[model samples]
Target: MKKQTHTVLKNVFGYENFRPLQEEIINRTIDGKDSFVLMPTGGGKSICFQIPALVFDGITIVVSPLISLMKDQVQALKSNGIKADFFNSSISPQEENEVINRAIKGDLQLLYLSPEKLISVRNTWLKQLNIKLVAIDEAHCVSMWGHDFRPEYTQLKVFRNSLPQVPFMALTATADKSARKDIEEQLGLTNSKLFISSFDRKNLSIEVRGQVQKKKKLQEIVNFIERRKNESGIIYCLSRKNTEEVTSYLKAEGHSVAFYHAGMNHEEREKTQTDFINDDTKIIVATIAFGMGIDKSNVRFVIHYNLPKNLEGYYQEIGRAGRDGLPSETLLYYNMRDFVLYSQFADGGANSVMQKEKLNRMLQFAEAKSCRRKILLSYFGEHLTDNCGNCDVCENPPKDFEGTILTQKALSGIARMGQTDGITMLINVLRGSNNADIHTKQYFNLKTYGIGKDVSFFDWRDYVIQMANQGLIEIMYAESSALKITPIGWEVLKGDKTIRLTVPTSPSDKKKQQKVAKITTGNDTNKDLFTELKKIRYAISKEEKVPAYIIFNDKSLKLMASQLPVTENEFLAISGVGMNKMEKYGEEFMQVIRKFKSVSKPRKTPTTDKTFILYKEGLSATEIAEKRSLSITTIFSHLSQLYSEGKEVELEKYVTKEIVDKVRIAFNKLDRKVELKPIYEKLNEEVSYGEIRLSVTLILKNE
Candidate 1:
């Protein structure tokens, strides 16, 4: 099974080997066992079921959540020479019938469906077919505890019960402990084997910025995007108005941009999505309604104009970048106002308490003083022993100083003020303000009242927020927006514990602190060659009516430029090349490489002598020399000069074929593109430098 899987990996999918747990999951499913897989997006979850579908004797039914996802997956599978199709609302009646008939006849190896369609058709064509395995994608949606819950998914249990003998596999990218348990219970998975891959995308560099003024923030975003010109990206805003404004601003700046929201008509939204997927638009300023199941693999960045509502949503949004295993980036801009806005929205929901808790956790992540990756992974129930150096915090770490005195002052103020006020009031009390509330409460008479008066209001506020994020103080949202001191704060006040807080640096200062390393490639790499190769790829993609990455991703093109493969075997050795791709497009690409190699060879200028001109006119060199009143030896020199210049010369008239063959052998024995001295020495200096040069030039020209 392992050997067969490897064969399928190379020959069909063009991959070299299985990702971490793909083989184990495939083996379990082939043995007819229930499996629950929780791997991140772009983590090769499709291969787990696709491999077993090819290995099993019957067809596999994959339940997808979105029509677009189904279409993309089916197209990708067909491109890899797999027998796959999808049955969804987007397809015509005749098309659906053809797919159903194919499935009934066992002509298709894999079939895709939505939960609503699958459950509704349980007793219809689905029950009659020989179903081998049932694979549920986006399985977290079945759990009400999941972030993106769909009520129709709850009916899948009934559909699962009807096919009790077949193995069931549920897969998702993001799921917490509670959601995982709910998924298992809701899906009715009995004795299922669980496979949880790490949720770390090492290629994505995560960065968060506290919101500045609107103009400054917009300029910052523009600068970020300018660095990644002509690349596809997604900019997520919190509202339709923001999306429109951002899209307009970027468009005014000459960027290819579009906006998407629920307020638009169906046709408008479809057009926007289609344009983005086809790379006609470089950026999409969209709300949360967009990008649930988007399958575009070359997105280079994902920027949040505002903070997301939860860790799950943020993680899933950032997962859209770098899907092609290339370097990508994610930027999140957040502030206290966004948190307040989210809190207000949560207050009106049914699960207000849970929503607020989730929002608070997200806030803590944004204000974290340590590695952002650590905080993000820990939220998904994975612990990291070391800091991931890819994120902003790890790259430009905040300055740490002894903040015990500051922490004690803030804690004493909160404690002495009766813990019945929010951050503003607490900061006011610390600064000894003369406001009406302070006078009414007589809060200025406390021992800790004016202790922090030397610090400005904004500075005190930032320090207090930092303390809250570090768990020295807790924000009691349900208790009239009061602040409560924790045990750690008490310890700090009593001088029993020391506290260290990170000083907030300005954005410009932080930017100056970052030092990027340079990347070097092989000597064969040429920028002009890479551009020419890209032109070929773009032409092929246009002809096929597919995105450029579908033919060959940017990483594959870079490898092609660096290695410069010129033969079938060498082209196949490139990373993304498989048997199918090599057979389909190998010869065309190799032709380009061969032509480039021939044109790039160093050549001397053509000779300009009248003797050479006469020789080229079909006159003998001796005759030309005699006609021109010059010596025969001089004409021979002129002939050697013409041959060395890579021009056509009658080499047989001067040197015999045997001598030319010996010189060619000597040149071949030495390294390619070497000077003539090495070949002369290797030939024992029997041939003169001029004759040797002429013979080498003729041999190279023939090659």
Candidate 2:
């Protein structure tokens, strides 16, 4: 059975191997048992049941909530030579009957229907078919604890009783533990095995920016979009009006963007979605109503223009990007105003308490000082022990410095001034201001006067706030908003305790923080080849009337460009290339690859070679990173790649022997060809990613 599943996986799905837990779930379901899958979006949840459907003799019934989702999956499945179709309102009655007829004749392997449609057809239409497996996509909708609760999904339990012999599999991308339990109970999967894959989408870099003025936020968005021109992205807004406003702003800035919202008519919404899927539209500024059913895998970025109401919704929304397993970016702009508005929106509902609680967690994530990915994964009950270096916090941590002297000066000024003034008055006293209030109070008589005279007034305010936050002082709001010293504050003043304060980010620092590392090909030739392949994919998509990704995702095209596959045999070896696709679109793509490879010359001085030269000059990785303005992780990754190419790199100097042994043990236990993340986790995350890379390179070098 496992071999059959693997065969089907390779021949039908074009995947060389199963993702973690996918094979186990598929085998359990094939053995006529129930399984509940809690995998992240783009984590191969479809293949769990789709492969079993092909392996089973009878057809599989997949209950999906959105027509767009059903259509997307069915289109991709049919393109792979699998007989699949969807039954929804989007299809005519004749087409629905035709699908039913095909299913009855055993000509179709998978049939998709929405929850409402399935319930409606349960008595009249479902009894006529031989259903082998029942798979529910977006199974979270069945649970009230889920972010997207649909009452119709509650009626889907009827399938368990009606098709008692058929195995059931429920899947969702963003369900917390509560939602997971509720889904099982609601779906009557009492004896089902639950599988939760890692929620970390390593390809998506998470970031959050807050406290910017409205104009500046818009300008930042414009700047972000400008850098990734022609790449697809989405900007989620809090309201329909905000969506239209952002869309207009982007358009005025000369972008191929559009707005999508519930308020837009169906035709308008479909056209916008179609344009986006076809790559004719580069950006979609929309409210939360836009991305649930979208299966477009090439979304390069996702921007939350306003704060999301809850972490579940936010996670699923950001999951829309990098679905093709390539690097993507997710930026969230939030403020207190968005929190207040969402709080009000969550009020008076039955789940109001839960909603507000989730919103609070979301806000905490936006305001978090730790790794943003850790906070997000922990919210979904996936604890990441190591800080993912891909997030904004890990990349650009706070500049902490020993601020004992700074705190002592402010505390001494506050005590000498009788501890009776507000923050502004304290600042004035410390900076030796000659203001009327300070002079009238004769605060200049304080011995600590002019102690902080060299410090700027703005810097003093920041220091005072930090002191209050650190419990070194208190802001007595009830006592006429006076600044009072706490016991901890006295200890600092008396030199008993030391404290560290982070340097506040200035406007220029904020601009520097907005820069993201671009995902690039190895050289100019690979990039040109990739561009040509995308054109071919888009042309085929136009001719076939499907999303370009349904033909071949950007990941596949990238691999084609990098490997320069110009023959059918070589093209078939590419990922996402089944024999069906190889037979259909292979020649055209091969033609492009052949022409590009024929004309392209060998490159000189690749990016990694530059790093090698710098390494040879005796500069440390940190020093090189500082000089190049690149992250230290990137520098290490470059060196690791150079080592992989058999270059003379002393990669051992970057990692300790203890780390090398741990990584070696982890790699030997797991699939060695897998990415670095699984190995990082297998080592219990005690090793940093850079350390893991260096250790793995050393292990392979020794082997």
Candidate 3:
């Protein structure tokens, strides 16, 4: 006669019906059945355990990995009106005692403990309380082969054996065949029932954007963020310094952004989390150190500024977005250097057996030809009805070619060239180059030398990358890009196997071959029109002391170009010009709008939702559409729905003409000024030079 969990779901959780698989898992857990929950990030994985714990007679123990995650879950649980707490070294002995007392006194339904904390001296006998359920989140960490492995996860098996009567569950977003098996074994849940939801997210478009230079790559990211303005999003950088660098860059660009990493003080990290959660900020540039339980739902996009260590890490990170069941996006910025670095870490060391396997799985995943989404689903033993056409590969499939002969020649050439020469030198030899090295080695006339004259250096390099991915050509980074043939490669070169490779397409060709982007402003030479409008918007922002986006968004600015509303009444008709802004500073901005309106003659409604999210959250619908794997029209449709439903406030609070002018002036002066630090620092204090710079950049780069 436990007061029905479904009732709690409807009343407190506010869900009339649990999404598929939720109730089954919850009921099983409440019945003390050990469970293996495989729900995706936003799939209500926590509900399965949180709900069951509500009905259980004892406190439910949640074993988490990171301090951030533990805190996030506890906070979310409290928000849901559930009694939940977490124990970590962050608290003093007195605080620990209070938490323990709460659990023992039946005042808490859920208690989150980091795996490291549980195995610590202070918490050794912690579980001696009336614990009924033990939920291990990010369960794949227990597997030595998972992306984020912890040695302490192995000790979870001991906890299960010690607390045998209590039910246990483990959850993760991305675990392939081997990692899943290892997690089950390591968690001592071999006999437990498994509950797996679909791994593929139809709305999440996956893609690897390759070969773009750093400046262009960053510009692409900025533009993407600008296109979708103020929705919440996370940008992942691979290194600690990079996290800080990106955070600084975005902040300088005029977005309210913050950084988080293992290198940061715990307090600073906590504050960053708070800023992001409270909506004081919308963008978080962080290292992998940030996720795993850091619950800030409604994140619209997750971009990997640097490639993730592995697909498991990539999957879990991207899973953070669209957790509220709305469309979200996932973009991974990949470079071959990232793979090489991760590979070097794999040759033994203290690397867990599972970490090694997961690393290999990620390698396999990167090389996968079938739909990226399909491979992910199939790995978890789920079947896909058809190819997921949401990934970059699916959207623009690299042209296919019969590389059987070329691959054979490359492998033979590498062996003959002594595994010491890098792909470049090897390729040169294959294509019959008589460079200094070849002339000095007296090897220019070899049979393979110059045989590949027909192949361009770029295409030949692409061939090498594909070969490295195929395991036919193993990369040797220790000695300057050397390509060594593997055992399988020997079999292939010996004509024992069929080797077909997909050539990596050149993104530049498509980009360059396209027509110049057409900007629909009212005047081309009167570029001064948009510039003048920006100056007015900047001026008002300075007086108001807010981000320029608060005054007039790109859409509104574009609308002003078309409508030219000189009066407040007419300006109000232009979208984004509501009552609040009209009262505050509408007269000045409306005048600027009127100046531009005389030319465009109101052809169509130019104000739009596309760049609105960008000005707010730095999301691009195309990127969003691509990241979420949804149709362009469908993403736009959801966006329109969201925009209409969201609260509409005044525009003047966020933007003005003075600040935009200042930012424009600052950029114009940077090259001329001897030192940049002083100018940028001064700008950060006013109209937030950091945020303005990023916006200005997006406008210039995309235009």
lDDT against the true structure, per candidate, is 0.80, 0.84, 0.68
Q: Tell me how many residue pairs clash in candidate 2.
A: 0
Q: List the candidate 1 regions with Cα displacement exceeding 4 Å.
A: 404-460, 476-499, 507-528, 599-703
Q: Candidate 1's residue-wise lDDT over 393-481, tens digit each?
A: 88778898999998898888888888888888888888888899989999989888878889887677778888887778887765765
lDDT of 2 by residue, 393-492 (tens): 8877778899999899899888887888878788888888888997888888888777889988757766776787678887654465578999988988
Candidate 3 root-mean-square deviation in Å: 16.9
lDDT against true structure, model 2: 0.84
Instruction: Order candidates by lDDT, high to low.
Output: 2, 1, 3
> What TM-score against the true fold does each predicted structure earn?
0.77, 0.75, 0.63
Comparing candidate 1 with candidate 3, which one achieves the higher TM-score?
Answer: 1
- Please report how far candidate 2 places residue 201 from its true position, in Å: 1.4
TM-score of structure candidate 3: 0.63
User: In terms of lDDT, which candidate is stronger, 2 or 3?
Assistant: 2
Error of 1 at 479 (Å): 6.9
Candidate order by TM-score, highest to lowest?
1, 2, 3
